[model samples]
Target: MKNRMTLTFDSRSENESLARVTVSGFMAPLDPTMEEMMDVKTVVSEAVTNAIIHGYDSEDGKDIELHCAYENDELVIVISDNGSGIEDVEMAKEPLYTSKPELERSGMGFTIMENFMDHVLVTSSPGNGTRVELRKKMVAKDRVCH
Candidate 1:
């Protein structure tokens, strides 16, 4: 088991960049490799972007929550939104699949997250909101000296 951190922000596209910065700071002390840190940063961005674009429809006043916990040599991140939920989880995750293709979305959010994170899970239902959880194991063998 290791340290844990959580962050929450209102549904605002401008806030997504800040989320990435914060996640970087949270994982920095762990002395993660540049690639690992980038992976975490990208996953956080995709999750937040999905919540903003799909979950909240780029609207304001809603909220998104991000939680990070380290345990058993792995880091777990949970991104959740309180907005219109997904109608179909399986279909949503398919490669090049997106509910907002008209907006030019590549439907690669889930794919990128799945590829970068060791494990990814999505749960949502109409009017209930959606949650995307990702987990990645730390590869460093020695104690990280920060």
Candidate 2:
């Protein structure tokens, strides 16, 4: 069985860092490469930021849930929010397509996610909510025994 942990936090901008750090700490035992560590952190940041900004529309009192698990060389993460869900999941994944252009959003959340993780799955429904599931296989590190 994979070791797993779940976090439920308020959808606050400051909490984004908290989410990143939490995952960083959780994955410590894997001895992931520096680049792998950074990639995981970046994806977590993007997912949390999207939930706070787009899903909840930056409203307070909303909860974002993050679940993380790892077994051997693979890591899995899922972030979800119960805010305003996405209407078109396919279009939302397109590059340079953002619903909130007025906010200067780059619309690259999913793009960046896909670039970093081995698998990215997004599920949402208008007024229902959004869930981002990410999976990555950490590069094996040469273990030297003394």
Candidate 3:
């Protein structure tokens, strides 16, 4: 089975959960394991939160895009924003390196995503935009026989 979805919404903190729920609901038919579901949700939350807070710098009226595709036991998720892009992608991915230390951000967004997902890719330029791609392979739960 193959399934895919794309969502676009205003870059707001409140809308972050919407992205997570949408992906979770989309993946329901696959009967993913509980751990897989939580991992997916966690990565979605991190990517969407980064798009709103870091990509757009909490500026209103900006748009964030989330795309999810499931095929052959693999799930691909892409989150993008057309806002101030990262100047240093490598540095940003380092643990505990937040751009907004004043906000008490731990700067672990990329790290968390990398740890949870099988593959992660980040692309950004200074003035263009930022895009985060996350991929995970779902292992089907073993059915118990009575």
Residue lDDT tens for model 1, 1-146: 47888888999988899899988887766677889999999999999999999999999888899998886668889999999999999899999998888999999989999999999989899999999989998786578442
Question: RMSD to the native, candidate 2?
Answer: 1.5
RMSD values, in order shown: 1.7, 1.5, 2.2
By lDDT: ranked, best first: 2, 3, 1
- Tens digits of per-residue lDDT, candidate 3, 18-54, equal 9989999988877788999999999999988888888
Question: What would you estimate as the lDDT of candidate 2?
Answer: 0.93
Candidate with top lDDT is: 2
lDDT of 2 at 7: 99
Instruction: Evaluate model 1: give its TM-score.
Output: 0.93
Model 2's TM-score against the true structure: 0.95
Looking at model 1, residue 64 earns an lDDT score of 97
lDDT of 3 at 125: 96
In model 3, what are the clashing residue pairs, if there are any?
A: none
* lDDT scores of the candidates, listed in order: 0.89, 0.93, 0.91
